[model samples]
Target: MGNIVKERKSRPVNLDIKTIRFPITAIASIMHRVAGVITFVSIAILLWLLSLSLSSPSGFETASAIVDSFFVKFVLWGILTALAYHIVGGIRHLMQDIGYFEELETGAKSAQVAFALTGVLSVLAGILVW
Candidate 1:
């Protein structure tokens, strides 16, 4: 055990991200986590909008005006894009949990499909937002 520990401690470690190459599945998984975070943060903005719209009539008008701005529309588009990606990634995870796409090749293919679907959804979201 002592010798094993010493050998393990002596092994080389690569910590530079620039030198690292991530597989498609790994990238997909990382993006899924990022999208989840974006979605979580966007919830606060959405709730604020909901609250404003549900307030007095003037508040509703204010919310409507805010939503009509180019910046707000772009933000909405980003939120929708993140949500779409998160949902796609979530379905992939569910399929994996059910024993599908366990192999490396199949997992990569599933990630690719998720990415493609998210791309299409993002385009649609952009169109809808604009």
Candidate 2:
């Protein structure tokens, strides 16, 4: 009995990623990652569309019809929005790496600027898409 080590029972750790309060900079970083994945997946769809359009006249018509569909247009708009935000976020990250927005205040300001720019551009893209 003495040789048997008793395991201590402790309260379970309350670490929940979703329950954590994230700062604007952290949120921006997370959005950047999400946008990157969206853009990457969109590339495959775009390539498939390109191939279809280039295959033959019937293929081109089908591709055109697909593009004209409301669902496809919405998806395309979302992809473009993701691209715009990703580009803005990437530029902010690059600036941070160059020591421009390393400070907390400047970093927050840069993130806000990126978000504002992306929002404006995304609106423009939506207008064009519609």
Candidate 3:
């Protein structure tokens, strides 16, 4: 009985992979989800601006002034960055749909390339828009 219980209590063995290596498509998929969230938040900002502009002439002026401020410009930069990344990443996905990056090694390299491109482009968009 003691031996039987000890054997039963032993945990199942699991593969130990300290570093999880995910493919390019997987990372792109995750980034798409995150960018979607950012876009959704941007929609909220648009609504707030619309409301401010709709209240009255002074309201519109106030909204205009607000938009011209450093804080508003920074927020706009974030929105642009999100949009840029989402657009580039989406194009990469489209490429994959067309039979590109089908190989495991090529897919991983392409994903790294896509990530780098998104970063560079998003930064450029931010600088220009801000």
For this target, which candidate reaches the highest TM-score against the unseen true structure?
1
The lDDT of model 2 is 0.94
Cα RMSDs of all predictions? 2.8, 3.8, 4.8
Q: Give each model's whole-structure lDDT.
A: 0.98, 0.94, 0.82
TM-score of each: 0.87, 0.84, 0.69
Residue-level lDDT tens digits of model 3 in 23-120? 66687779877987898889988899999999999999999999888988888887877777788777877888999977888777877887898789
Query: Between the candidate structures 2 and 3, which one is better when assessed by lDDT?
Result: 2
TM-score of candidate 3 to 2 decimals: 0.69
Per-residue error for 102 in candidate 3, Å, reads 1.9
Residue 111 accuracy (lDDT) in model 1: 100
Across 23-117, the per-residue lDDT of candidate 1 in tens digits comes to 99999999999999999999999999999999999999999999999999999999999999999999999999999999999999999999999
lDDT of 1 at 115: 99
TM-score of candidate 1 to 2 decimals: 0.87
Clash tally, candidates in order: 0, 0, 0
Candidate 2 structure quality by residue, lDDT tens digits, 1-130 = 4798889999887689888787899999999999999999999999999999999999999999999999999999999999999999999999889879998888888999999999999999999999
Given candidate 2, what's the lDDT at residue 53? 99
Q: Considering summed lDDT, which 10 consecutive residues are worst modelled in model 1?
A: 1-10
